[model samples]
Target: MQNRITEQPSNYRDLEKKTIEELTKLINTEDKSVAPAVEKVLPRINALIEVIVAKITNGGRLFYVGAGSSGRLSVLDVIELPTTYGVAPDLFQVILAGGVDRLVEAREEMEDDKNEAWEKLEANGISKKDIVVGISASGTTPFVLAALARCRKENIDTGCIVSNPDSPIAAQAVYPVEVITGPEFITGSTRMKCATAHKMIFDMISTTTMVRLGRIIDNQMVNVKLINHKITDRATKMLMRLGNINDYDTAKELLFQNGSVQNALKSLNPDNYPA
Candidate 1:
């Protein structure tokens, strides 16, 4: 068992007596502490990401599993990969303790069902070709722990994002990331600082992985989806800038014809296009 840093008592006292301004300032102060915590674990995060990139590049997929707030955050992370980076939707998947179909509802009791995650992964045909990341701020979610243990038994790659050190879930993770976010301002409410840490790392992983996979060009989201007028307009402008076209209509026409920023650019520069 580990010292559950996320479950520690709040450093502040008499919260109910504080003014709203004081409360906000205190919470903001605590929130500021989150980045330093995540900063200390960047090396571990980098190592895990390297493995993820290698596996995913070789046809492997990424899977995130967790419960409650962690589960919801995991859902948010992978769901946007397609629209944000133009990655294939099939490349990222999330298995929430509460069914993804029930994402709008808080089915906390489902977290106790230790077998559900494993069953879901099995049904998804999870194999050694996939990398499973368990997200549990307390580092003790039964759903995530059970799934990671089973993945290990089956020789599948396993990693974890946890806020506590030496936790059971972390023990099961071959590549464990312990961000040690101390304690939430609301005691055991991990949706605060812990959530912030996990969210930041999720962004890092997706962005870096997409870049390594050739989805990004320079510092731009050259693979973004133009699903709406705003994005279509933005992509048109980006194409004009990146492709060095003088006419907006020409850039917009090429962008619409090719579907995405990357493809649009490729159409204009076939000689320098990737495979």
Candidate 2:
């Protein structure tokens, strides 16, 4: 393979000879650079997020298409939206090249399946109302590239998050975010820094979209799912604090009765909430 920055040798050589502490510090230094790399692409990221928000608010959906580590990370990001922001499960979808069932199996060969992502998106009934964002560290994953190409040909809005510049995936994307994370500390282990950048960007996109979509009230996740004791307890506390319910048990009771922090708060005065 041709030399990309990701394929270059590590700056600190003889890694097997280094102590655990030395290795950790070296990796830490490299990891610190990831945030700045992402910062440089904030403008591009902002543009892509604007498009996503527009599409989703109009009853459209968002789809993340990728393979390998990128695909798995995208899957993780989308799965959290329903619980975290109370959006519909289908609002943020993911198309993993090998399917989510094989996500952890290290099925790297699936990245070479250029036709799979388009098929997956088509199966999902992707339309111009939906926006598909491709994720790839090298910006050359055939799975992602082909999907974006198909989306463009069909006039669907398309975007991409990649770690390299002037890559094929970016060329196919209408709004391409290229966060140059430089070389990986382990020289090709994109699961480290590249994944971090993608995670941060995903956080930005999903959180901002949710907040704009009215899932958040103030800084709290008022619409968050109360699926477990931990979250139930947290929501109860929020209800007590926001609704001025001095009694803890009463606040907890209200939470169970209403089912969500937003609902609990609105119950205090129906006039305060929209019809």
Candidate 3:
């Protein structure tokens, strides 16, 4: 067993004696270290992202398997990709320990089941083409570790995000990112800095993957779905700017007709816009 720094005693003691303001300030100070911890592992993160991009480009999907806060945070990230990047919802998926349907229930006990994660992955028709990334702040969550071990046995590519060094979960991953955020402000409560690191890393993974896959055009979400009036209006303006159209109504009309900024731009006539 590895020394789990996340479970070590916090640097700050006498928490009960601290004032509300003092508590908040101390927590905020600890939060400041999370970004730097994640930064230290960028090379490992880059390696994982490269594999993810290649697999996705080759028609494979990305699967995030996690438990507790790590799992819930992944759900938030995966759900936004479709509307934000205009990609299929199935392109990114999450397999939470207690089933995503029961996510709000906070079934922390489910993380102890060693076989459930692999069973869920198998039911999804998991294959070698698809990549599975485990999220476990403790680096020893049985649900996540079991899944990664099985994935390796089945010849599937695996990666992991953990806060402890030489963790069993990291050992199973071909590409492991150990952010090592150290002890949480609340001792073993990984939902603090560890969760923050996981959330930030998820943002980096999804956003960078989308950009590399060309879902973003010049830093703009040109492929974004016009799901609501606000999004539609935004896409309309984007089309107007990118298509170089002079009239808002005309741009909105073309945007509606084509369904998105990317498509509307494609429908524009080369000679219709001023040079």
Candidate 3 local lDDT, 107-131, one digit each (tens): 9999999998899888988999999
What's the CA error at residue 153 for candidate 2, in Å? Answer: 0.2
Locate the minimum summed-lDDT window of 10 residues in model 3.
266-275
- C-alpha lDDT of all candidate models, in order: 0.89, 0.87, 0.92
lDDT of 2 by residue, 38-125 (tens): 8888999999989999998898999999876767888888898899877799999998888887877878888899898888888888
lDDT of 1 by residue, 1-275 (tens): 64988889989888999999999999999999889988999999999999999999889998999887867987888889899888788798999998988988979899888999999999998999999999898889999999999999999999999989889999999999999888789888988989999999998888888888998887887888888888888888888888999999999989889888789777777878663
Candidate 1 residue spans exceeding 4 A from truth:
none
For all predicted structures, in order, the TM-scores are 0.97, 0.95, 0.96
Query: RMSD (Cα, Å) of candidate 2?
Result: 1.8
